[model samples]
Structures are given as C-alpha cells and as structure tokens.
Target: MRRRFSLLALFAIATLPLLVVLAQTSDAPTCEIVAPDLGSYIGDWCAIWIRVDDPQGPQTVENVTLTVTTSPPKSKSFVYTTSRYNDTFFYANLSLPYGRLELTATAVDDSGLQGSHTIWVIHPFPVPYFNSFDTPTIHFFESWGEDLTNWTISPAGTWHVNYSNYHSPPSCFYTGPFSGPITITLVSPPINLTNWTGEAFLSFWSKINQTPSFTIPPTDYCCVEVSTDGRTWYLLSPYIVGYWSWSFFGRYSLTKYVGRIIYLRFKLVASSSGGGAGWWLDDIIVGNEKKVLVLDKLVKHFSCDSLDEWTYSGDWSVCTSTYHSYPSCICCGSFSGNKRYTITSPRISIPSVNDGQDIYLRLWWKFLIDQDCRVVVQLYYDGLWHSIGEFRSSLKRWRSSSFWITQTSGKRIKIRFMVEGYSNYASFQGLWFDDVTILVFNRRIATKGNITGWFSTENSLWRVTPIRCYSYNFSLWWGDTSTCLCYYGVSYPLDLWVDLRDVDHAYIHFHAYWNFTDPQSCASLRVCYDESEWVLLDTFMGARSSWTTRQYRINGGCVVRIRFQVEVYSSYAIGFFVDDFAVLPTTSDTASPNVSIVEPKSGAWFNFTNVTCVWQGEDDVGVCEYEVRVDGSSVAVELPPTTTNY
Candidate 1:
C-alpha cells in the first residue's frame, strides 16, 4: 500500500506543472523569464524571456499592451494578434529608471478575456560611458516626417506632426483640439541655431460656401500676427475681415521677423457685424513650405515654317488666338509699301518664360526692297500690344529686331511686321526665319559714330539716301566742290578724304552691292601712312559680296588719306556704296609733333670734361619725339631721324 501511495504522489507532481500552465493559457499567455533567470538577473544586462503554453491550445489575445509604470505609470500599447491554434510573442527594449520597474503585459481578445503578467525590473546597473559633442545641425524641408529623432525641430509644432502631399497647400499636422501661439522651440535644447533664416507659412483650403460670405456677411474678422518672442505679438498688414459667401479656403501670409526666435498666431475675432454662419477651413498647411512659381506654356506654335521656315528653341507654332490668327508667313514678302505686305502669324501664350532664361524668336527675312523703306517689328505683352525694337531696311541685307516682355503672363506671344515708307515704295522679298533668339541686355556696347569717306572713290558711290546722309569733317567734299571728288566706274581705285579734327580712333565701313555678275569685284582697303606709302590694313572682297559691310579701326594721329582700289569686275558686276563713318575720341589733336627739350645745360661740360646738353620742346597737339646727339650734345630730334634712316 505504501508503494502505491508513492506512485500516486509522482503522478500528482507531474500533473501540477501542466495545471499551472493551463490556468495562465486559458486567458492570456504570461511572459515567462527565459534568459537571465529571474533572481540571476541582478545587474543591468538585457533581460529577455519566453512563455510555454502546455494548455490553452492556441488562443488569440486582444488589447495586449505593455505598461511600464515604475515610479510613474507610463504605458505604450502593443497590438497582439495570432491565428487560431498558433502562439504569439511580445517584446520590448526600453531604458527603465534605475528603480523597481513594474512591467505588465495584458491581452484582451475581441471576446474580452484579460490575462496579464508583471515583471520586477531591478538594476545594479553597469556604469554606462557616454561622450557628448556638438552634432551637426540638420535641416529638413516641411515635407519630411516628424519621427526624425536625431534631428532638432525649431519653431515649436515641429514635433507631433506629419506632412502629406495629398493636401492642396500640403503641410504638417498634429491631432488636436489645440490652438495656441506657434513658437520656435529647439528639440535638442542648449543647441541653438543663431541667425536662422527660416520662413514658414500657414496655408489652408477654404471656399466660400454660402452667398453671405461673398456679400460680406455680418461678423467675421481674421488677422495674422507674428512675434519675435512667444509673448509680444504684432498685427500684420492686410487682414481679411467682413467675409462674403464666395470666399472659400482662406490663406494668410506672414513675413516680417521670420528666422528669428519668434512665435506666430492666427486669431479670428468673431464679430458678425450682425453674425451669421462662419466659413469652414480645411487642409491647413504649416511649417516651412514654399510655393514654387510654376510657368505653364499654352500655345507653342508661333508660325508655319515652310521651305523658307524659321527654327526655334521651344516648341514652334503659328501664333494663333481668338482675337488674332497669324497668316501663312513661311516666306515674308512685301505686297506693297502703302499697304503693308504684312503676314500676321498666330500668337502664343507664354507664362513666366522670362525667369532669367533666354527667350528668342528668330525669323529670317530676305528684304528685297525695290525702294528705300522700313519694316516695323511688333510684339505683344502684359495684355497690351507693342513693337520689337524698331529696325528699318532698304537693301537686301538680313536684319533682326527684338522686344522684351518683363515677365510672361500667359503663354501666347505675337510677332507682327509692318512696312512703313519714308519714300515712294518699299518691300521685302525672299524672307525666312529659322530660330528666334531673345537677347537679354545687361549693357550694350557703344556702336554708333560719325561718317568717314569710303575708300572706293570711283567704283563705289555714296547716295544721299536717308540712311546714308551723314555729316562729318569731310562733308565739305560732298558736291560742287573741287576737293569733293566723285568718280564712278565698274572696278577701279578712288581717293576719299575727310578733314578729321581731334580724333583717336576712326571706324570705317562700306557696303558693296552685288548683281551676281561681277563675282570678283572686291575693294582693297589702305591708309596712306606717308605721302607715298600705302599700308594695306585689311581687304573687302566678293566673299562679302552680298550686301557686304566692313568696319576698320584706324589709329588716329596723322590725317588719314583713305583709298579703295577694286581688284576685279566680272559679268556678275554690281555697284558698291559705303556710309556710316565714325571717328571716336573726337577731341584728339592729330597735328604733327613740335618739340624743344630743355635740360642738362645744352652743350655744357659735364664731369671729367664730358659735355652734355638737353632741351625740351612741346608740341601744341602731339609730339613724336626722339633724341639726337651731335658732338656729344643732346638736342630735339625727329623719330627715325633723317640721318639715321637715310
């Protein structure tokens, strides 16, 4: 019988372990201390544990939370979910205060059964070593998340907020029935960002729902105020008050003392002059969110570029709109002078294309003017019509003029041309345009000057045309004068002269007419250095055969005797004309040098019986001087003295 009792006792002890687990499992799993067996875990060493369920057969738990309420009951909720007949685990690694930490894990299923376990957290504490230094200050846009712990947030409300692009003015948010002065609070205190230049704005989507809001219903007044400190506030200008039914999502901008350690607040003084329904505000955006100035291109086609078409940078289109439609101007030709042979291409809508970017609408025009005339270039901007820079052409030369539209309003821009006549008839033929370029002028180089005579005296003639009529020191030789010589021929040399006053540099230019016959008729440019010496500085030939123009820089001092000698003429012969003569530094005296040096006692005996002499001679205008010594005496001399050169 004693032997039988021993067997029963063993069976009872074995069943007791299963019973303990069954009780815990029937409700919720208890967090069992697996690693660092309870008493063995003395000092702070990561304590971990696991639970074994011998009963309760795979039960799911709900409302499972971890409450670490030590001296203070702080709790963090954890979601515990498990498939039927499966086991689940709960884990956390937190720095508990160096006291008795009361850790409780509880689970309540949807059926509402509660099971909890408490662990005593004690720490002898391993002395942790920490070194601190100034970490780099991090900056993030308003779009960044709030969970960034390593970074510091300034201007309070940076924490407990999130950003989403889904919003209209998209911004940061915090769940709240909270309203107070928004401020700049450093997340990592003691680390201050000095002279910070941060700007933030509050943008919300609002719409005038009812008609009263649009008609200025009774009592709504709103204002945005800012402050350098969280306390003292200053009201900003332009406050919204007395609403109308049409006013919807409202937005206010505040920018005065931003970047400063300041606070911003939005206050609505509800005063319904008589008081009705207030407006609704949604999608509020706060924090540093900047709106990008977006530019949208509307009509890209400016013109139809046919064979004689124009190339452009952006999408090219025929400028067309409701008010105006551009004509098929692939090739621009003048129909007549009195009636402008104008082909109006469509207009294009350009919004904000003037943002420090280059804008050019280039078109080519083969201006075959049968007579002297001017072509008017027009441009439209800012709801008004205007002209590109004015350009007039009489010959077959290609010319371009541009206008400026400070900022693009809409995408549409128009370019128009008009032929105005100062004379009988004018026309443009064989005109073409490829790409357009808009030149931004920072500063323009000075390029205008007086008329100097053309070197080609015979083969080339300067007609008294409006664009050619220029007065200079040489104007005395125009007509009915013995000195004013005009000799006309096919290919030959001609002498032209102008009595230039004080001048340093003279700009010489000429235009050659090409009939395509004389393919070789070219003018050789030369300046007479002395009475007999002609220095060929540059040459203008048939390469510049088509409406040819050449500019030469002549050093001013001696009066220039200019000459143009034509090399050859052929079947494709054409007449050449030159105009637009300019002399720069018009005050430069070109008179010959006069010198009489005075110094060192002329012809006087120096030390050790050596004789020395010096004299100073001054020229009323310019002096090209050199020193000459005869019999050991310094004296006024000529440059490349006659004795030396000879």
Candidate 2:
C-alpha cells in the first residue's frame, strides 16, 4: 500500500500546475530613468527619480547616483534618499542653470556591479526670471531643508513643508518639531533684485498660530532673514514679540537690496521644541502680481445609452456588448476592418480661454482597425470643418482620452469622428465609444478663502497640473502624453471625513468612471472610524464604458474618514474618476429617483407641446434636478431643483 501511494503521489505531482521561480543572478542592477523622460522643458524646479532594479531585488541594490555633464562635463553625484514604485527606485533632485544638460543615472548593486542610464534635459528659463515652481525639487531655490527620512516626522525644509495647517489647502512652509525641537533653514537661490522700484517687495502668508509652541511664545517663532552673495544675513520684521492667532499678510520693502542679487530664508528656531502643528508660510510672491487659481467643476454628462444627440453616415452603430460604460457606445469598424464611417455630435458651445475658462473634451473609445485606416476628429465651425486630431495607429482596448480644446474654444462647433478604411471586409463589431462629455473649468485667481482638504499626491505632475483637477490632479495633462517612466502617472489619494457618531449604519455610494489600459492601475476605498484600524471597504479595477455605481456600508462609529486612492500606470487612458460621493444614514435606495405627477393622471392624453406637466421627485437624499421625458424622449432637462410645473 505504501509503494502504491508513493507511485500515486509521484503521478499527482507531475500532473499539478507548473510553477516558475527565478533566482538572483550575478548580473548588475539596471537603472530606469523614471522621470524627466528623455527631453523635458524644465521649469524653475527639476526632479529626477530613477528606478534601480536587480534580480536579487530592488531593495537589495545598494547606492544610486545621478550625474550631470555640465561646465567641463565632469560628473557630479547627487544623493538619492527615497525609493518608489514598490521599492524600485533611488531618486534625488538637482538645481541647474538655463541650458541643455545630459544627466546620467548610475546604480550599483550590493555585489558592486554597475548600471547606468542617461537622458537630456533643458532648462529654458533664464535666471533672475520669475517663474512658478511646478516640479518636486526647486532649482530657483537651493533647499537646505532635509529629505523625508521618517514618515513619523516632518519632511525636509528649514521651514518644513507641512500639510497639517495651511493657508493653502495642501501644503505650506511650516516649522514645529513633532518629536523634539529642531532648527530647519529654507534659503532661496540668487534673486536678482536689481532695477526695482520702491514698490518691489517680498511677501508671504503667516499667522500667530504658525508659531504657537508649548515652550514659549517667542522662542519657537519663525524668523525671516535675508542675505546678499549667500554670506551674511540680517533679520526682517515685523520683529516677532509674541505669537498671535490671526494671519498676517506681510509685504516688506526690498529697496535696500535692489543693486545686487539677494537671498531670503525662513528660519525655524531651535527652541521650537514640543508638539505644535508648527508655523506656516505660503504664497510667497516676490512681486505684486498675484496668481490665483480657483477650480470650478462644470460637467456636462451625455449618456451614450442612446445616440439621439449623434448622427452616423456609414457603418457606425450603437453597440452594447463591450463598452467603457454599460449598455451602449457608438462604434464602427472592428478588428481588421476596412470601411469608412462618420459620426457627428451636436454643436458644442465651448467657453473660450479668453473667458478665463478652459474646455476639456473627454471621451472613452477603443479602435482595432488597420494602419491604413484613419480616425479623424474634426470641429466644424467658421464655415468649414477643421481637423483637430487624427489617429492612424491601432489601439484595441477601451481607452479614455482627453483633449484640451484650444483655438476652438468659445466657438459653437460640431465635432465629427470619421473612420475611413480602404478595406472592404472589416468591422469594429461596435461598442467603441461611450460617456462623451464636455468639462468646463473656470479659474479665478487671487480669490481668498480656504480651498483644500486632506488630499495629497506623490507625483510632481499632480502638484501643479493645469487641467483636470477638482482641487487635485489626475495626470500631468489629463491626456496621453505617454510619460510612463516611474510609476509615472496619477495617484490621487483623498481623505473624506464622515461623522457617524450617533448613527448605527451608513452607506457610501459613488459613481466610478474609469478606463485604464494597464493591468496594474487600480482604485481602493478604505474606512477608518472611532479610532479603529483602517478597514478596506472595496476596490475596483478593469475598464468600463459607462459609470459604475458602488456602495459600501459602515455599521457604527464616531468620526469616520474614508480614503479613496487611485494609482494608474502604463497608459494615460483616464485619471481617477469617482464622483457622486455620499455618506448616508441608511442603505435604503440605490435605484432611480421617485417621481410623481401631481396634476396629470396616468395614461392621460395631452398635446405634446401645449400641455403643462407638474411633477415632483425625491432621490435618496433630496431632489437635485428633474428631466421630463415624453414617450421616452427628453422634452426638458435639468429642470429647477424645486419641483414645479413645466
């Protein structure tokens, strides 16, 4: 029996699924330049991160250094103190002058073998130029502030960059030691204050609460200092006597330093011991011109479940099988297709950039046609249809694409997506596009008010992204720039506060919209309440043609916080899109809103255009807006939130 069992076991083992495992070899680790891909027009700040990988494991690889070939082309090494992409990188920042630079990132494994990757970078702005800092590392200022070494402590900066309390929603220069008293210095690079009038000054936002330390009022204060030629320094005032609660927007004259280049720094004094959320400074403007950015989210949602707002000329049809959203998408020419098809959208009246607004054209689509075919997106206005974009390549997956409508903004234009293939026997099998929308973003700068929450982004692209943000960025350009270097994409992780103190149960519902080509891209929502450990509520992946509704329930808690995080990789199909977020006391409703006609009886006949209809509706919360449909065709939309007769 033992011999028979042994023979049977051998046969079972041979029939089991095959597994493959790789062991570490003596090969040297390789360096992946995760950022500033090849050639990037660098602004005032330049950040370089390199992913160092080895067969033994990226963590086992030792030191990584970056060298720039400038000024006689000698290699200068910089210390990379951080790792990213699941511990596949060692990265750092560099301050360089305006010109072309060839950067070499070299990594060495524990075995002492070396690997290197080099790329070119250009800093176009001339020094003494006042430009914004959009990168993670600033070249306009040489930071004496330290890198973030421990998550338990504040990050590097003499005036540490903190998010606890802010004049801005997310970050500001702050000083206060959470663990103990420590002095940090943040100094500016050369600021040529030459040729300045008496009005030329330096200014920052501060308050007494910035230095409300436990040790003493004045000891833990934030000191503003200045220097010329980077040597001797002098203190500037309102000389601190005591800390206050109100914010002081101070503007100090720089008339004395006008003849030469000067330096400025915020000093966090050593006596700033004990726990205070720390001193805060933000919106440090050197001149009088203030740049304010206020984001107003205006979304025009058009359901593709039916193509009433569209027209097709050829083989295009509404498909339901595979879509970014559910139920439908207008498509034509499937895999290996060769047919000409044209679809036109209703005239889109976009607010122009001159109106302090930008228009974003977002759509979800997939194409599997041949290279000989062409997909052209054209805008018809000003007497003729002008081409906005054209695609000749083959993309087979459902993808989200965004277009920053330039030149065409402010014009009422009709868009046409035309697919022309010379072949006779190709079909897209339909289901190529859905959820076409026009997003209008209006920015009002210099507006005073708090506009942020506990939202943070890890990538430099998200820090100052121009478009596609609801107070946060989903990508460098909400479109396909293909800057897939590091985990080089969008990672929007937001913390939403929910008070479930007295409630027994609550439901969280949100409309999730996404189209990610990379299998690694994903989104998650985690909940924490009543001082409990973080509990995962749910996670979502895969592509969708239409929006998906997800709801999770929390039984009980005091103050609750939900963290919604999204990490995208490989493609810029779309950014993290989760909307209609709500925390309700009950999971009573997940269906359509209830509506009742107060005046019109059921099945009553009335003239379509002459009759008046009075109706009232209530969604789970309350009525948002109402749309009236007659015979399944919308006659009126976005009616007043208040129920009324139409």
- Indicate which candidate wins on TM-score: 2
Kindly give the stretch of ten consecutive residues in candidate 1 with the minimal lDDT sum.
128-137
> Per-residue alpha-carbon lDDT of model 1 for 144-239, expressed as tens digits?
122223324443443344343212222322322222222222221111123224344444432221212233432334444556655666764244
Query: Looking at model 2, which ten-residue stretch has the lowest summed lDDT?
Result: 135-144
Q: What shift in Å separates residue 618 of candidate 2 from its native position after superposition?
A: 14
CA deviation > 4 Å runs, candidate 2:
1-299, 334-339, 352-356, 422-431, 442-452, 455-646
TM-score of candidate 2 against the unseen true structure: 0.31
lDDT of each: 0.39, 0.56
How big is the positional error of residue 353 in model 2, measured in Å on the Cα after superposition?
Answer: 5.8
RMSD of 2: 32.5
- Per-residue CA lDDT of model 2 for 495-528, tens digit only, reads 5454455556666655555566778877778987
